[model samples]
Target chain A: MRITIKDIAKRTGVSHSTVSRALGGNTLISEATTDCIRKVAQEMGYQPSAAARSLKTNQTKVIGVIVNSIDDPFFSEILFGIEDAAQQAGYSLFIAASQYDLIREQNIVQTMMEQRTDGVIICSSSFSADKGRQLLANGFPVVVVNYKANENFNYSIYHDDVDGSQQLTRHLLALGHKKIAYLGNSKSGRTSLDRLNGFKKEMRKAGVKINPAYIFEVEGSEPELGKDGLHYFMNLPDRPTAIMCFNDMLAIGFLHACQQACIRVPEDLSVTGFDNITLSAYTSPPLSTLDQPKYSIGNEAAQLLLELLGNKIENSNNTHKEKVLKGSLLVRNSTSAPLQNE
Target chain B: MRITIKDIAKRTGVSHSTVSRALGGNTLISEATTDCIRKVAQEMGYQPSAAARSLKTNQTKVIGVIVNSIDDPFFSEILFGIEDAAQQAGYSLFIAASQYDLIREQNIVQTMMEQRTDGVIICSSSFSADKGRQLLANGFPVVVVNYKANENFNYSIYHDDVDGSQQLTRHLLALGHKKIAYLGNSKSGRTSLDRLNGFKKEMRKAGVKINPAYIFEVEGSEPELGKDGLHYFMNLPDRPTAIMCFNDMLAIGFLHACQQACIRVPEDLSVTGFDNITLSAYTSPPLSTLDQPKYSIGNEAAQLLLELLGNKIENSNNTHKEKVLKGSLLVRNSTSAPLQNE
Candidate 1:
């Protein structure tokens, strides 16, 4: 009862090869004839089986993307950019979240391999350089995204976290904030670590001895932890004049705590966040943070993936195995000069 | 150097059928044997090809999900819920964005069909009932989420949006706000219309005449539009004392606009949002909004799809054709009695 290309050829009074070519999007067939064949095929319920075609080409034209959490606004925007680029490049995506679990990450990779996806891009999943090398050795085109650069992997794309955090720290210093605190989230792998290093480097350059008591690393990225950090910091003998958070989400949490504790931002304690998410712009006082090229990172990741798969792009320099994008500073209402008393 | 099941069997010193059963995850093969065979297969770089196996059993063991935007925080939470359930059910996901474009939606559906996905769950894409009917008629299982109920399709799951919005409206009314303007984003198909209608219905029940001037339907769901809406309303001759937004994102935008205008929340422009996204809770004043069961909707959708696909579970009611989850109002710091002024 299944309809086939031959049946369509018989119905259209065309050769089987012509029907096949039209269905396969061959430009050799006239547009009018292709349209007619497509209409007939749709009416007849002829689904061009990817499974059968994949057997011949050994390519699914599908890419797999694994992220820390899809719900995190940061990953979502990157995915947005990735999708836009993937659609144009004629590849569908198999997206999953690892939730920062290594076992789940491995299972997802194995599944993508078994499905024989053309390539994969991992964004913030904790798959190591060694494992990435193994996949590459097994002839898989892989790209590690939003992670520290590992020399073992042939392909990767990440942000300049060190520069970004340093810029944020100096921004606070320029505002005359000497007694600044850091609200950190160490759980998100090396990106946070890099951000912390940048913060420390800028502080050291200004001849400020790093205060161990001022650095607070929390468990999660939500505002609740930030709020909790605020309570702990406020109870200290000498509260910080400003706070630099791991990211905007944590900063927003601290801002929320300020509202609860009757402490005004920038006046009582200036705050700066990393990764200027869309929501960060709408937060009360419109968060001052580091503007990560989230969408571009995703877009370039997909572009790099296609180039790795030997897809020729017009006027693109695909010679580079890895692309490093930079994050800029977005000065908004959340940061300002420290109060005289503070 | 491609290895086959025969090669695997020879190495494992097991019959080809036993190797097949073990690889297939059949219970007939003992766990120890299956583990040994899997370890050997992994060592040999053996990939059980989905294409070859799908030819025997025409299922992909994958689900395709198309949403309006993953960057939208609400959709991400729903997806969070879906991934949790899907992972437990042992099905991987192929997620993409339709971006509310009908052609793209159809193309995605066609792509999913060609890939032989076991089922699809759509979150606010522009796939109409007729197209859904056509897909169902062609024997594809589809679940429509946060969409209106259509009799033509036996599968659908939606939030009780009217009830939820009415609750929000009533909450605003109880807080002593009589003149309230709605900052709505109307482009989002049925969900938006249903929300607007719920707002009106509650006002009508309270014996208040609906003012057409106060109902401002914005373009997109972003905060910028909401901010623009706030500017227009603030400049009005007799601005409403309270504002109800289409969702929390709009409410946050309005909150931002208020901060820029020196308009204090609750004390000046009391505001409310819907769909209690996680970011909403962190916004200044902890936005009062309606809580939609985003995760549950996704979990139930997958559960229903599995049920429809005849995948059995312990103590599940597969007879239910549809599930409608309800949203509840969460009273927070965003709303209060209106200031006694014009």
Candidate 2:
């Protein structure tokens, strides 16, 4: 049975044009008329063709989200928050995972643009910043989440990593640990650099000289690196009694390494981490870490993007609009005063 | 400056209709023309309206996913797998969280249908089985993930929960645990029932009487419930020396409760959990669990949906199709032989 706009109009007691407008998803139509038309259309099992419609109104109502990796809990939570808000606003999301490859990220963005997405949200790696800026310059309404690009031309939403790292370090200092080590990813991006600086700043403020040997940079946040960091520090002639890691994944890894080495946590050594993921509390002797408001960050990013797409705010060349949320240190069972030298 | 297809046609010395057809995202156009027109469109900053094009093609190229909860690690990983496969197929995904509310699940499906989504993937609570059947009856292409419904009219992709649970119980039995306690959610769904039945089947096969006192159902899968489950069991006159939980979250809570009570894991009592999430390995003494292929399940579901949407296969109601993935148990530090006294 063929279903048509005329049939829907006849069933709803409306003109074909009105039925067409309602079926076209035009918000300008009366709610009652649109509802009536939609009911009749659903009853008739009518399906509108996407190809012919693109020729008339140039909007797809689909938002594209490009992320570096979806396996990370942090990014996954952000994606969930974005999906929640997008669903509420009656928009569908198309996601592309670039797997931290610069060329892949660029290709995904270009593809989304060609697909005629309404807007884009990018969580890119350092290698893709240039391409990201180009997309923004091309007048694509883009929102950069988590990563802070060296080139500044787009809207960005990120947690205050610098402040969060400083607070974590301060907590360690207050615990009477004079020699503290900073374990983090390779200083390749702004996030790592900012965190390293924050650690140094807090130590310097406390009149403790920064020990060059105490700081370690690694490749990834896997448990092996954490174990290697522990092994490296444990062998040092004058190893610091405490260490602070860049994120929780590293901390958990380090914790496991400590157990393997028969080194007790908060006893033989004190360890701290950032990003208070759900697994933190479940770890044996729970982990002490900093908590980033991941959900809120995603929520705000979507809210801001919706404003831009809805024309609720002026799209001007203003450089002062930035949303920087703060992170908090959550004390758990992992950190304590170093054991007295025995 | 208003850039239009006519301007691009004039610049390229082509007919406007040809340019429109070329830029209309039709695959029938030659690659050369599509490439030339796309290059010209990009150069001209031609933004195609996806909203308008979807009206004529009847193909939004979008899939709607409704899950019971987004925060659960199991569901999140499944979603990631789905997103990966969908993105690879050039399809977009829109996700909705029902929070296990039947009414909200129905509402979300209705909205997705109204938007004329190509298909939907639902991981709903068992209480919504009737509504799910109604959706399938309405000619919506749907694939149920994780949960099975009453009527087998739609596609279903899930793990072999019964086999996995029985394997876990048999493992505990081999470890010299005769008195085993079952800690799980209320038996209001097929998943819980299946898991419970698997345990009972294994126990009966071993010629052990099923102890009604050993099985306790909690209100939810929260930390509080874990603590309550422990208290309820520990208060019994003849408490089991070993316990098996429904999922990792509950296992974590149970472990925390044991910690507070000073119960030595693997020494006084052994505990096991299903769903070996990344956190399970990080827990203190690590949680022994059944590892489900969460990501693979999601990937297969998306792949199946894409195949259906592309009309790559014929629909045969008589053909019975089911993809049941097997799960393996990872023996971590959490499980051991029962204590002599208990």
Candidate 3:
């Protein structure tokens, strides 16, 4: 027969409540009592039941992590961060992939709630402020990653995309490139809009007018879109001298297309990318990209959710704060001065 | 006030147990009664508590998946399959990563047991037959993935690694490669041993003498190990013209080393990898590899566990069995006839 906490309490001549407190390592319990109970529990080989304890405390110590897709390397790094932080806090994680489907996101959220997960950290593409608010209203702590909906919704962690994009554009401008093309995700998302706005702002700051024909948008996160974007720009009557892509995946596709066309990187054209995934370093010519604090963002989000579960923060209204992480530009072999002929 | 089953029963003029059966869509209940109860429950805006129902039935409709590490793309692909299949079966998954630590694996198993998880699917690297026997003794339905302990414990889902490696070696031999080297993982795992046996068997069948100096063992899964393996082999007086890696990651590392050394793939040497990951296709020269059905293996494991949970399978000792999935060789840009000279 399996040993139970009750048996340990009985053996230690302590009340079950006191035994529970001691086993949980509550500071309110006397040190001597804690040691005694712990010793007895160990001797008896008693294992605390997570389900029974959760029923009494209303906290499962389980964090639900929902990602847009698991196949993407960017999100995988973020998940690693979240898992690392969660493990440090004596918590386990339950992961689900939304697969970029809004309905699936909703379903996953509902399932997490049904599981009575103490909190959730979401790296979703289509999650809305309204949904976050609904969860908050239902007493669920949620931390949104990589996207912010509204300032009113609490617990959001994102990179400063606008600033990051602005810096990237300025670097290109400083390199003496005047005709620069932007390849990015569709404007449906706030992230894409922010990046676009930042690129335009940087261009205006440099006293250069934004060229309408130099901007292209892709509908999804795939390298093929990047290839298509490159093909579209290259066919223009006056093609830009350089291209800035939304992410490294797109940049890689662009590079592959250039390779196929016998166009050398940093020679015939210079290209830059965002999100310095590990693969960025291995690509031919090595991609010059933005290094977003992907892992730290995930870690901080998990930390915030842990705080909420611990009741370190009171009330949902006060938790409606945004944490924006900074990004950096990693210059590798991919970018250089534009050709003098171009 | 939140509506409960009692309220629904009262409104429907039926006993609470009958109402529960009807609302649960239990086959024991009449179809007309189920319809009536469901209508009344809907009218009352009654939501069934999954937790409460689970407590009564002892079935959470949740499967626990424990993986050795989530950082590897191989494990990630397997997880995707498990999650997809579980969702389709109206079951939810709770994932835990052990980070390749044995203690963490044990703790995860204990936690899953405490949660009353219907069944478990473990894709672990360090589990022993003793642990498997212990779990079986405790009446837990477990499907081991990627590793098998003993025939005493049932329900294993794994690819034919030995056969897969043999096929890979034969492919290299058919390409007129006389000197073939084996690049494999450390001797700590059965997977590595199986692959080594396959490679040796194929070489012996081809009447080729095995050179001990040509075999290299990587201490870990790090890409740097692959580079080191390549450098070690290249420095030898008699370097093999063809190299067969234990897996795709090692192959990628080897490829990276070749790129750095300015050694052209399939020209200076031919290379092959196992477990054809998505990134394998994007690697320079692409990778010729064995396509393991990682996702399908996970799906089958989950399905087996679910069947065990539903009592659909016989629990008799003799009824337990292992399922082996076949793998195929994916010929890509990485391999060709070896050059006339090194």
Candidate 4:
């Protein structure tokens, strides 16, 4: 059996805390007590933990990872990638959820600091500069993934939301969709704005006048948000022929809502979504969405953080500190040529 | 800014390890040297990490969580529950995926031990007692959720697979369906057998003899497994009217396969699944499955671990060390009465 401080405390008749303090070389403890505890600990063959090595070398071989939520399929895929990369690099991840709350983000960061992780990777998009200031001031290494702000972080990996949105919009336009609505996620900050801007830019290029009333932004980006968006559009007197959603989750909710309302997709309305999560393909009629390459994003983010920690592995792409990958448009059963009802 | 051992080492012109050893009270170091390093650490106002507190109090306020796969929706929902419960008790989670590999499971357990987490919760059903010997021999606190094995573990929480299976079978029988098939996962050990036995018990109770050919076992439990099961059932000369799956993922795959073959659910065939995961509800026709109370299982598992750690919260149920909860049958669009043939 592995021996611990409690075992030594039991043998030496001292408190476990005293054994810990004496072993830690805390000067407040008398030399006689320290000597007695050390001798007993040595006799018991107590092995020092990696944490003990951490105290000596100042490296714990652990990385801190913060995500928006654990159950979200999008983040889960990303986490799978992160875990694979970190494991290969001989590092374990300390995972925490921020749940898109500032106080929680700060608290998680603080906890990571107290744990003295070598570096941190933030997969939560809404993580602000203020929440990360503690780590920054200490010259701690951090790599952000798909974060809105680009000024503070020296290393980051993100998907090109604007470009991906334009591709989705262009596909709809090519299919003869003139009245296209953009359903966005207001909580996603810059991601929402970028996708919206991309839709507007693509419309301008096609010489199409935008219907401002057709564009709507909701507080969330889940399937429920998409459901709510469908209700709003159905009530609109001049609802667009096609609706572009923020992500796959919202698109799924919209499709379910359509099914309940007896609206035939592409026959009555067309729908498009960004971030092609795994479930997107299994949805009824499958979903037409953008392939976000979530796993790759996470893998690259961990690699970037590893690089920042000065352990750049051989043959890694280390040239760019900031990387923005584009998403591909997947045309599936959820979208097609809208009914010509001029 | 938090001053670390490196800061003190830099000021004293000594290696960080020497500074660490000197401060930790290692006897190998000279008395004068230890005194000097301690004074420098004090002068620099270096804040001892929570790890230091861990050494003193024998607690790190961290819990290690092991799962079969990080991205599996079933496990993710359970993780969501564990995270919520751990956070409420001033604890953080260190999550790892075992991927159902024994070596990986052992490695993860070793890593968690090395980190000195207060306790561990194993959500991986395949975790063997031999793999946990390190933690066990050291008298480490462990709580398992839905583990197949009952021996060697004092605290465990699991869904009543047999009872849930019977409930699902009874529902199918009530629908006047006598021809039923069971699709199980080979890797799930006792869980698969228990569920299969439950189906058998219910069928026998109704004076129905099950066809050995109607039952099939696959190596996996994913949606892909369900799809493969469907192919096998479809080729059989005497295909059953309804198929009962081991879990929600497989059921989803089966439904998708039916959709591809133009086989209308509940009209040509009926399907049911266990562990009513969130995605199960979003399937094409929705799913008629057993709700396993995944979140509650996880929440209670963490709470049980907390109790084992001797921090039992007020009003917490600490009555049973071995608790098996029953699943409820959810009848949706999947199962129905088989067409009559004379």
The number of the candidate with the highest DockQ is 1
> After superposing the true interface residues, what Cα RMSD does each candidate give?
1.2, 4.2, 2.3, 1.8
Better of 2 and 4 by TM-score: 2
The recovered share of true contacts, given per candidate in order, is 0.92, 0.37, 0.29, 0.50
Candidate 1 clash pair list = none
lDDT of 4 by residue, A1-342 (tens): 457788899999989889989988999899999999999887775756877668667788999998888778888888878888888998999888888877778779878888888888888887777866567555568788889687777778999998999999999999999999989888889989999999999999999988988899889876767778988998988878999998888888888788878888867899988888877887777889999989999999988888777754421333347899888999998888988673
Say which docking band candidate 1 falls in.
Answer: medium
Model 2 residue A54 CA deviation in Å: 7.9
Put down candidate 1 lDDT per residue, B10-103, tens digits, no spaces: 9999998998999889998999999999888878888788877886687878888878877788988888777777878888888868777777
Scored against the true structure, residue B177 in model 1 reaches a CA lDDT of 81
Worst 10 residues of 1 chain A by lDDT: A311-320
Best by lDDT: 4
Per-residue CA lDDT of model 2 for B235-266, tens digit only, reads 99987888999888889889888987888887
By lDDT: ranked, best first? 4, 1, 3, 2
RMSD of each: 4.0, 3.7, 3.4, 8.9
Whichever of 2 and 3 has more TM-score, that candidate is: 3
Please provide, for model 2 over A274-303, each residue's C-alpha lDDT reduced to its tens digit, 9 standing for 90 to 100: 878776776667889989898888888887
| Candidate 4 stretches greater than 4 Å from native | A1-48, A311-320, B4-48, B311-320
Q: What does DockQ give for each predicted structure?
A: 0.73, 0.37, 0.44, 0.40
